[model samples]
Target: MICPFCGAAMEKGCIKGQHEMAWLPDDKRDALFTDAHLQEGAVLLASSSIFKGSVVDAWCCRVCEKLVVEY
Candidate 1:
């Protein structure tokens, strides 16, 4: 993918996490969330779990040090 920040080429990759992965709002207190109680605007990269990693597709731009992911 092409980076939107610096007009550079981006590398396709995965965002891995031992637990859940998400982009949460700054004002939010805890990262934990259930499917029924998911916060607004929270982009969940991976679901919460134990002993298993979560992998999400992402694009990284080395030039701008930016990462883009889709939920």
Candidate 2:
């Protein structure tokens, strides 16, 4: 996708790490990802839930040095 802010090309990528959705605040969790894009079969609903690693699709705008995520 193209960056709306700078008209730069966006590269596809993923963010993989120890992301505990349950540990994150409800508002933050909700805001971090779009409900439509979240994969099926939820494994995280609270702070105690854990995953091997969290991978979220994202786009990088090197020109702006910023990341845009679908979440």
Model 1 has a clash total of 0
lDDT of 1 at 59: 93
Per-candidate TM vs. native?
0.74, 0.54
* CA RMSD (A), model 2: 8.0
The global Cα lDDT (0 to 1) of model 1 is 0.76
What C-alpha lDDT, on a 0 to 100 scale, does residue 40 get in candidate 1?
Answer: 72
lDDT of 1 by residue, 4-71 (tens): 99999999998887767767678664644454127777777777567667888899999989999977
Of the candidates shown, which would achieve the greatest lDDT relative to the real structure? 1
Specify the highest-TM-score model's number: 1
Clashes in each model (backbone N, CA, C under 3 Å)? 0, 6
Candidate 2 lDDT by residue in tens digits, 3-67: 98899999999666554342334444454454422534444432222655566667999998888
Candidate 1, residue 39: the lDDT equals: 73
